[model samples]
Target: MASPPVILLLVSLLFCIATQRLYAEQAPNYTFVKEASEVSPLQGRFDYIIVGGGTAGCPLAATLSSRYRVLVLERGGVPYGNSNITRLENFPRTIADDRPDSPAQRFVSTDGVISSRARVLGGSSCLNAGFYSRASPEYVAHLGWNGTLVNESYPWVEAVVANVPIVQQWQSGVRNGLLEVGILPYNGQTFDHIVGTKVGGSIFDAEGNRHTAADLLEYANPDNITVLLHANVHRVLFRTRGRNQPLAYGVAYTDNTGSTHRAYLERNTRQSEIILCAGALGTPQLMMLSGIGPAEHLRSFNISVLVDNPGVGAGMADNPMNAIFVPSPTPVETDLIQVVGITPFGSFIEAASGLSGYAGATSNSDDFEPYLGIMSPQIGQLATYPPGERTQERIAEAVAQLKVAVAANNPAALGGGFILEKVFGPLSNGNLRLLTTNVSDNPAVTFNYFADPADLQACVQGIQTIEQVINSGSFTDFRYPQTSTAFLLNLTSSLPINYIPKHTNDSTSLEQFCRDTVTTIWHYHGGSQVGRVVSPTYHVLGVDALRIIDGSTWNFSPGTNPQATVMMLGRYMGVEILREREQS
Candidate 1:
C-alpha cells in the first residue's frame, strides 16, 4: 500500500514524461531535405551558419533558430536512438570502446597526441561518461565572473537538458561504507551536499537509458536544425576590403564524398553571423586553416595570415584520476552504474542541489544530490594489523566476507565471487601541444601526471581511506585480506618522483607502488583559454568574425562535468551575437 500523495505524484510524473516523449517523437512541420543534393546550391542563404555539431554547436543552432534561419554543419552522421550513443550502462565498460561518438574519440593530431573529438553528428556528447558535475562557486569567482553558481548558469543549463543521477542498487552497501569511513573524514566539506549524491547509485532514464546532449536537445520543430552529417569544414572563406580589414563571408567544407563546397549567411540584406562552434580542436584547426593564428605558424603552414592571434592554441589541462578496488559481499543483483559518495559539508550535496540557492536545480530532472554510494551485505568485518601491514589485513578480511555472502545469496558460486573496483577520482594538471601545422595531424599530449606531488598524496589518501572504511567494524565477521592494485602490478618505482634505477626483479618502494598503479580518468580540457587565447566574448583575438565556444576555451578545467558549461556558453554567446546584431 502507498500513500495517496505519493501515488498521485507518481502518476503526474508519468503523464508529464509521456507528453514530453510524444512531443519529441512527432515530426517537425517542415519536411527535412535529408540528402545534400536535394537542397539546391543556393537555397536562400541562412541568417546564421554554425560549424561543428558537438556540445556548443547543437545548442547554438537550436537557440539561434528561434528567430533566425540557422544552418549547422556536422562532419559526422546523426546519432538518435543509436546504441552507439547511449550504450554506456556500466562505468568500467564505458572506457573499453575506442570509437567513442565524441570529438575526443578521434585519431591523434599532428602533435603525436591523442585528440578526443567525435566526428558524429552529436559530437563527443555521444561518447562520454554520462556523469554530470556543475561548475563550483569558487571556480566561477576565480574566473572573474560575477554570476553565482545558484543564479545564472547551472539553472539555465538544467532547463534545456536532463542531468539526473543513475543509481545502482546492488552496489550500495559497499559504496556507502567507503564514503562513511574513507572520504568523509578527510574531505570535510568538499564532498558534502553535492548533486552526485542524490541517487544512492548511478541513475538511469525512466526507460533505463543514459542521458546525453542528444537526449536533452530533442525539442519539437526539428525543421530549425538541419544536422549536415559527414560534412567536414576545411576553411572559412573571407573577403578582404582593405590592407588590414577582412570580412567573413562563408565557409568551405568537404562532404562525406570528399568534394569541396561552400555555404554562406546573408550579408547586407539580413543581419547574420558565423559561429565557430567546432569545439577546441576543430575551432583552432579551422582558424589556422583560415589563416587566423600566430603569423609565424600560419606562414609555416603556407597559409595567408588573416588575424595574427598568437594565443589561438595554447594552455592545455585535464582531470587525472585513480581507481580503488573492493570485494562484494553478496551476489549483487542491482545496477552498478554509478554509486553516490559524499564528504562532510557542501561538496556533493551542493553540486546536486545546484550551488547554494538551488539556482540550477530543477524538478523535471532526476534529483541525485543525496544517494551517492552503493552497498551490499557482502562487505563483511575488518582485519587489524601493524601500521604498514594494515592494508594487507583489510583486503583479506573483505575478500573472505564477500565469499561467504555470495555463497549464501546464490549458493551456485560455491563461495566464490567477483571483485569490485572504482576507476576515477580528481585530477592534476596536464597539457596538449600543436604537433604540426597540418590540420589533418593530431596534437602531442603530455599528461605530465605526478608532476605535482599533491596528485600522489591524494591517491595515497584515497587508498588509506578505503582501508579505514573497510576496517571500521561496519560489517560482521569479515576476514580483511591484503592485495593492492599498486602492489599486484609491481608498479612501485614508475611514479614521477620516485623513479629509482633498478635491475630486473628489483623490489618496489611503497611510494613507487602508489604511483605506478594509478591511471587517468581521461577528462582533458583547456587547450585554448580565456584571458589567454580568446576574450570573454569568446572571440579569438584579432579575428574579424571568429569565436571559440567549447570546453577548450575554459580558463580552468571545471571540477565536475563540462557539458553544461559548454552548452551554457552556446546559449550565452548566441545572445551576445544577437545583441551585437541589434546594436549594428
Candidate 2:
C-alpha cells in the first residue's frame, strides 16, 4: 500500500540504520556519525525511549536498558573528540567556554530573568562544575517522599556511575572566609570549635576520580542500549480506541538531516511502561506538546489537553543565594574549596527544614552548615512580584546598587583580590509554558524573582552580616567601605536607579547600596513537582504507563547542585520500573 517515493525513502533509512549499527560496534566509545550532507529519515523504535540523555536521562537509560530495549534521543551530537568533555582537569564555568552549552542556557537571554537549561546528550551536567552532594533527607521527608538521600538513593547511583570527590585538601578563598566572620556573631562559641559553624569538606582524598553518567553510557554494554545521536524527539504518538482516552504508543522525531517520521516497534513488541527522564524543562515541554498539562493553557496554545493536570507547570522554586566576595591579602593557588555556613538556631526554624543540623553531622565537622558553589542553595525570597512584573524590576534595581558597591571597592575586576558575591534568588513562583505545540520550540521560562520584600530582606541581612565580618576581623587590614556607611550614603544620594553599575563612594554608601546586583546561579526547580505535576508513583496524574523522573519532579529546591539528586532519582526509578515489570 506504500507509495513508490515513500517505499524508496524507507529503504534508504533502513540501510543507514544498519550501517550506523555496524560502525557503533567498532567504535563503541566514539560517535557514530553520518556526515551533515547525508539525508536520512529517522525511523526507529524501542521499548523505552528517553529524550535528553543528560543528568537524569543518562542514568535512567543505562539502568533501564539492563533488561528492556531502550533508545535515548538526544538533540546534540556525541562529543567523541571534543576536548571540553574529555579534559577532566578544566572544570571552569561553561558559559562562553568552547564546551557545548547545556539546555539550561536555553531560557537565558540578554535580560537576566529568563534562562534555559542545557540541550545536549549529557544535558547540563556536561557543562556543570561537577559538584556533587546527596540531597539531604529533609527535602524528601518534607515532601513525604520515601527515598531521596545519599544512603537510599546515592549508593545505587554510585554503583553504576562515579561521584568524583575532591582529589586533595583546599582552603576557602578570602571572600568566603570574610563572609564566615559575619555569621560568627550568631554563635557565642569559638568559630573553630562550633559544630556546624564554619563550612568545610571540599576536601576529597583521591577517591575514585568522579565521572559522569555519559561516561558510563559509552562504557556500558552496547548491545542493550542504543544512543541515537543528533536525533530530536518531536512528540509522543498516542493511539486511542475511541475519544475517551489516548494511549502512548511511540514517538515521532527528526534526525540531523531534517527528514521526519513516526516510529513504533514490530507488530507484537510490547512495553510495560515508558519513562520520561527528559529533565525539568524538557519533560514538561514534552508533556505540554503531548497534551498533559493545564487544560486552559493548552487550549490557549491550541495544544489539545490530554490530561488536565493544573499542577503540571506550577510550583517552580529555586535558590536565591547572595555571594560574598572578600579580597585576599595574598594570592595563593587553589582549586575548588568549601566555604562553611553558620546558621542561628532561630534561622533553621525560619527556613522550615533541619538540613543545617544534618549536613553538620555528615561532614564530621562542627561547621554543620551548607557549602555553596555556584550551585549551592542559599535561602532568600524575591517572589514579591510575578514573573515579568514590577517586583523583578525592583530586584534589578537592588542588584545595580550592589554592583556599584563592588566597583567602588575594587576598581579592577581582573585582579585576584576582587571577589564576586552573587546573590541567587528571592525566588519567583513561576511556571513553564509551551510556546508552541512543537516540542522542539523553546518553552517560556520566567523566574519572577524579587516578588516578596521578605526575599530581599533575607539577602539584605546576609550582605550586612558578611560586610560586618570583613570590617572587624583580620579582614580590616584591607581597605573597603563599611556596609552601614555605604547603605546610608545611598539613602542620602538621589542616584538614578538602573540595572547597570555606576560610580559610588566606597566610604559613604550603606549596605543597601549593593542590593540589586544579585543574579541566578542557574538553580531551577518545582515547575513539574512530585505531588503536583505527577503522582507519588512518578506517573503523570491521569496518564497510564508514563512517568516523569528528573529534577523537575522535585517538590522543593534543596539549595545545592541537583546533579546527585537527579541521578539518584533515575537509578531508583529504573530499578522500580524493572521490578514492577518482573512482577507483572
Candidate 3:
C-alpha cells in the first residue's frame, strides 16, 4: 500500500478530474445571450439568421453552426429551468396559464375554436403532447422530398430526444382496444410509418423528463452559434431595385428589454440567408408584416406590398379534436400519448389520461372570459367580414352563453381520467390573416373545421371509432358507466338548458356535440406552404436570401403528430442549405 499522504493526493486528483467532467456536462457549450445588449454591437452580419429558436430552428441552427456563423433569435425564454414546462404532471398548467408570456400562448380562433402554440425556445415541441411519429410515407412522397436525406436526418433528431415510452396498464389496454376495433394488425412499437395500431416514440425519456429540440443544440458548434432568447423578429428587411425581385438582407427584432436591433447578411455572400422557423402562425404573420402577402390585405393595414403573394397565410389546417372524458373510478397513471389508432378514413385517434381532475376542476366560462378578452378583438373583426359573418357570430354567442351556464352551477370536479383526441388530416379551406399591422397581435385564424363536409363526416366516424375502442373488452373494467360527454354535462347541469344531453347515442346528437365542442388538438400547419409560399427548396418565392423551415412550410398536415416531421424537415433544410452553399 502507498503512504497515507500519497493516497490522499491521488484521491484529491481523482475528485478534481470528476468535478471538471461534471461541470462540462452540466454547463452549456453554446453561446446563449438573454439580452440584445449582451451581443451588441451585434457583429453587423451573420452567415445565417434564423428567427424562432423552436423545434425546427434549434436543430437547423445546430446543423448550420457546424459550418457557418449562425444567429438564432427566439421570442420566448430558454426552457432549461421552467418547472411547469419540465414536469409531465404540470403539462396542463403550462397550456392553461393565461399569462401573456406563458410557455403556451393560448388563442381562440375566429370560429371560437380554442388552441395554443408553444412560446418557449423549443416551440411546440416544448408544449405538445410529447407523442412522436414520422409523417406517413405517402406524405413524404407527396412533398417530393429527397427520401434518402429524410430517412438519414430523422436519426439525428431521434438520437437526441426520442425514447421508447413505458407502456403502463392504461396504455397497454389502449393498444389492445385499438386492435380489437379493427384499427389493425398491431405493428408493435416503432418509429416507422405502418398502417396499423402501433406504439410510437416520445420526447419524454424514461425518467419522464421532456427533452426538447433545444436540447439538440448540444451538437452545435459552440464557436459559430449564438442563441438569443426573447429576441422577437418582427419583420424581414428587404431591399428592392426598380422592377427586379426584392432581396431580403436582414431582420428587425426587439429584444427582451424592448430595445430594437437589426441583423443583416453580408452583401457579397450568396451563402448568407435569413430563415424563418417561426411556427404556422408566427411565420405567416411575419411574412405579411414584411410585405409578402395578399395585396389587398396588406394595403388595408397600410403595409407596403413587396411580393403580392396571396398564399402566404392561406390554407391553414388543424386537427379538429373532440374530447370524451372517461371518469376513472380509480386514478389512472398520469401519462401523455402512448398508443395511437390510425384509421383508414384519414382521421387519427390517440388517447391521454390523468387530465380529468384538471378539466373537471376548471369551469369553462371562468376560463373563457380571459381567453376571449384576448381573442374578441380579432374575432370581432372577422364578424365584420362577409361569407363567415354568421358563423363567427354564432361562435361568439356560444362562448358567451357557456360563460352564463357554468357560473351559476360551478360543477363538481371530476377525478383523474382519460381524454381521447381525434385528429383529421389536411382539409384545404382553413386560413390565417393579419388582424393588424402589429406583429405582437394574434392573427385571425379560422380552421374551417367542418366546412369541407367530408372532414365533418370523417370526424363523426372517428368519434364513433374511439367509442368502440373504449367500449371494447380490453377496457371493460376501466370503463366509465356513463359516456364521456354525459359525465361532462352532468358536471354542469345547473339549469334546464336547451342543448342536447351528453349521453345522446344518435348520430345526429353526436354530430351536434362535435360541432359544439370541436377545437384544435394543437397541430396547426400550412400557413406558408411549400410550392406556394416558398419553393420546394424551402426558399421564399419572389424574394432572395430568405427561407422558411417549420410547420408553415408543409403543404398539408401530416397524418400523425407533426413535431417529428417538422424536425426532420428542419434537418433536411439545414443539410440542403449547406450543400447548396458548397455548390455555389
Best-matching candidate per lDDT: 3
Give the residue spans of candidate 2 off by over 4 A: 1-44, 85-93, 97-104, 109-111, 114-116, 144-152, 159-210, 265-271, 327-329, 334-337, 340-411, 417-427, 468-515
Q: How many clashing residue pairs appear in each of the predictions shown? A: 79, 59, 0
User: Model 3: what TM-score?
Assistant: 0.83
Q: Write the per-residue lDDT of candidate 2 for residues 484-525, one digit (tens) a residue.
A: 434423432323222223345555333344444444455677
Better of 1 and 3 by TM-score: 3
Per-model RMSD to reference:
11.0, 14.6, 8.7
Among all windows of ten consecutive residues in candidate 2, which has the lowest summed lDDT? 346-355
* Model 1: per-residue Cα lDDT over 1-584, one tens digit each: 89999999999988866754554344334333143434436466777778877777776676676667777777765554354344332222222223323333434322222224566655665655444445556666676654642345445555645444433323344355555554443222221125333332111354434444444345413655565666677788887866365667788876656567789868764356577777656676677778876788778767889877776666545443333333333323323223344333211211110000011222223321111111111111112222223243454454344344333553222211111222132344444445575444555555555555655665555444444544544422221245344442232222221122333234654345444443323355665578767787666665456567787777555544566566656666666666677788
- Model 1's TM-score against the true structure: 0.69
TM-score of each: 0.69, 0.69, 0.83
lDDT (C-alpha, whole model) for all candidates: 0.49, 0.51, 0.73
Candidate 1 — which residues are off by over 4 angstroms?
A: 1-42, 90-104, 107-115, 144-153, 169-171, 182-203, 220-224, 243-245, 269-271, 327-329, 333-441, 466-519, 579-584
